[model samples]
Target: MRTDSPRLSRPATFVRAFAIACALFFLFPRHAHSQIHPTVSFEVASIRPVAGGESGGEGGTRSQIETTADGLTMRNIDLSEMIEWAYKLQHYQLSGPNSLAGSRYDLRAKSGDHVAESTLRLMLQDLLATRFKLQLHREQKKTSVYELVIAKGGPRLPKDKSATIPPSYPKETFPRVVDGGFVFQNVSLGDFAQQLTEIRTIDLPVIDRTGIPGVYDITLKSAASALLDPSGPSILTLIQEQLGLKLVSAQDLIEVVVVDRFEPPSAN
Candidate 1:
């Protein structure tokens, strides 16, 4: 008599489990990626002030020219293509923690399209930092301005309260350190004054005074007299020199990117 037991059917269960595991592995394969390393930031050592030569013109009628001949002149520098490539090269390493020092990567677009190698992000940051000599600082402050109020029979309030300029900006009140490039925030006024003697000035055309508002307008502190000219050496030049990178053209599309190959250092 042949014995029919439950053990005879155990092989089928093992086969089913193995097949399921294989199916899952192919369905969601891990993307092995690496982390882009950040390089050392650089700073400008000295700046020399440049003076503009006067254009020869005396009296209003001193300049006279014949307009019988008509002409048009155009000047152009073709840096647009270079800028586009630089922008494309700034891919941020979007990856998670990995075990290895160098992570494996298969960079791709949202549609699963292949992009450049995963190491691009670290290369770009290092390029910008070294070339631009970018310097960053942070500071914060609590603004206090007296509002003129008609107290009993005192005075009338100004039409524009926001426009009213405040008196002295106390250091204690302005304790928050926001990101900026002020070299004297932590130093004493005396030390800052001495530091200024070492710097050079190069007067450049002003595009925007958003970053250095104090340079454009007077602040509460008399010691905040440091001036800057935008036309000369700046963060923009530093990035170009250290990293061989430039801004993307006005027409180029910018996107936040992530890659599979790179991982952060903390993972190590």
Candidate 2:
């Protein structure tokens, strides 16, 4: 007599089903799975409006932003500045309501201790989109820019010795502004070009074309106020003389962010 195979127990049936599902998941393509996952975001976040004229930490301005491996903090910072940080865009590349610079807010966000800075920026972008209802688009436009190139004497940048210092040594501050000058430590040519854009004298976007590799410790002693004084040497002359670098003006198509819509941030 033929007898039907003994019915499997409930636990055995469940085990078989789970094994099949696991096999299917492993067999699926990786890209398909990635499409199902959501973008990384902060674990916790707080955003509040700071009163007008209020100051942040010592020497901090309305646009100050600090980031660590664990999180990031912004005090008395406006949306325009935050957008710049989030998208790694220069001030001239951002086009939005002038009011974006007027509404200041303090933001604190928490993330995994090992999260990278780039990932934090992405999270901040997500925060702005969800919390502030920010909407924007990028378009190319012709703009004036400066290319940073080596002067006739070649580069005179000092090597950053701090790179060899032990980790225990106190870190030296860089890209520092003093009296009428500026100092940059452990900076690459690209970074130096970006920092130059922050100076009032350098009104156009600075692009690095030096083709020089490695970091440097550079100092520019020219007075920023001198930019307004016709008698004083211009920044172009100062850079060429001091750092053996020159800024050449050129017109190019640059990608710019244009704000389509933005609403005041929702309640925390």
Candidate 3:
């Protein structure tokens, strides 16, 4: 008589579910699985408050965080801005304590190795969790926002005539501060939307509604005064006039990052 082999005990419900997901991921087409999220953490990190609480030249996304082979430095950046970089969300998309909104910090994080900008964001998230006790959730909320769309005439910016389809983005990326504002070359529509969102021109994060796809060259500039004047040409106007893209007003379900709690960092 053959003895029956002992049956393997089933794992907990959550574990079973996870195992099933993994099985499906491997058994099915690769595209069926979600893209792997890059995670990079700092080997040694320090977070300090900006003494003056004032954002100077080093402020804004353009100069927010710089990652080198050895480490990364974030200067004069508020928690709000930091979250924006970590999650790639707009400041308007985040909500938390009033103080946290304006509280800026100088962060020095090192990993001893160079990583992609996308990976750097992951490291920033880890740093926030370890230091700031940051926590957040995502929800879709109905909000009135501008959708970037091609105007009746089409885009004012010219397509890169010499741009030939390449396997990837250009190796020689142009400097962002070409003419004082922001310039992009060999950029895709998705990348352009992301750049526009970081500019803080529109009150709400812009949603790209343009049906256009592919890479192109873009130059955008707006006088601070122009954006401040309600009657003057705003970023929306600039996009329409210069880029031939319009930000149409519409209500859509937008992803909003909800901050549950954020405690101040511990001692350095």
Candidate 4:
């Protein structure tokens, strides 16, 4: 009854089936953990305005967050700072009432479960949404940006001999401004890029293009503020000459923070 076809032997049939199964498994692998972050909220929280207008105010955002099994303490900050920390957004992006820039508050909260800084930031966003009655939307706006790229000389960074994780420093490690240059010891390229974004000279946020990985020391000679000298080389230029990195002009679609509504925070 068989015409032009030959039936596969049982061993051949099993091998073919096994090969197909392996291919499918490799093609679509499943992750044990979810990649998307969850919406987090604190169990109980308090917010209060700081006293003494002329006395003092924390100039910048708190770089640290203390989180315990059931409690969190973040101090010397305003609602605006909280919003910035929560969204990982720059202060300039915020658009709302002028009062937001003037107010400062201290926040203490307890969460149902232990949370990491990343999760806490998400929770803070929820807090802003619920407590502050914050409403906002993101719109892509064309903005001038400085794109980081390898210069003509190539990157001069010393390759990190340490393991992937940099050795623990004596104190909380931070990039230091020394003399006419900035020095970052034991820092990842991504973290360095984040630091560059903080500089006011950079109109738009920095986007890391260098694929160099692992912890390394970086030193760049430039002022953090906008370069005033028309004749002098800009920070973008200094980066290339000193650090073997250059910034080229480019147009980027930035997430413009549009604030629809914001109300003053009442004492908690």
Runs in model 3 deviating more than 4 A are 1-40, 53-63, 158-203, 211-223, 227-235
Structural similarity to truth (TM-score) of each candidate: 0.18, 0.76, 0.63, 0.62
Candidate 2 local Cα displacement, residue 68, angstroms: 0.7
Worst 10 residues of 2 by lDDT: 165-174
- Candidate 4 lDDT score at position 12: 100
Model 3 root-mean-square deviation = 8.9
Task: Judging by TM-score against the true structure, name the best candidate.
Answer: 2
lDDT (Cα, 0-100) at 190 in candidate 2: 76
1 or 4: which has the higher TM-score?
4
Query: What is the lDDT of every predicted structure here?
Result: 0.25, 0.78, 0.69, 0.67
lDDT of 4 by residue, 1-268 (tens): 8688889999999999999999988886655234554556888898766564321224443333345566566555666657766787755556667667577665788888766667777788888888888998887778776677788868887777457542322111235776756776656666676667666566666666788776777777655332556566777777777778777778887776777887776456
Summed over model 2, clashes come to: 0
> On residues 1-268, what C-alpha lDDT tens digit does candidate 2 reach at each position?
9999899999999999999999988899668856786597899898888776474443344345677657888777789888988998867789998988778887889996657778888999999999989999999999899999999968788876646743222112225766677776556687688778877767899988889876667778864656668798887888898889999989988899998888999988
Ranking of predictions according to lDDT: 2, 3, 4, 1
Better of 1 and 3 by TM-score: 3
Q: RMSD (Cα, Å) of candidate 2?
A: 6.8
**Model 1 lDDT tens row, 1-268:** 9987756357888898899999988886654222233242212111111123221222121111111111110111011111112233211111122332122111111212222322232233343234333222223323221111112333121122223433212111011212433323322222222223223431211111112112111111222232344654563343234323222212222232222232221210
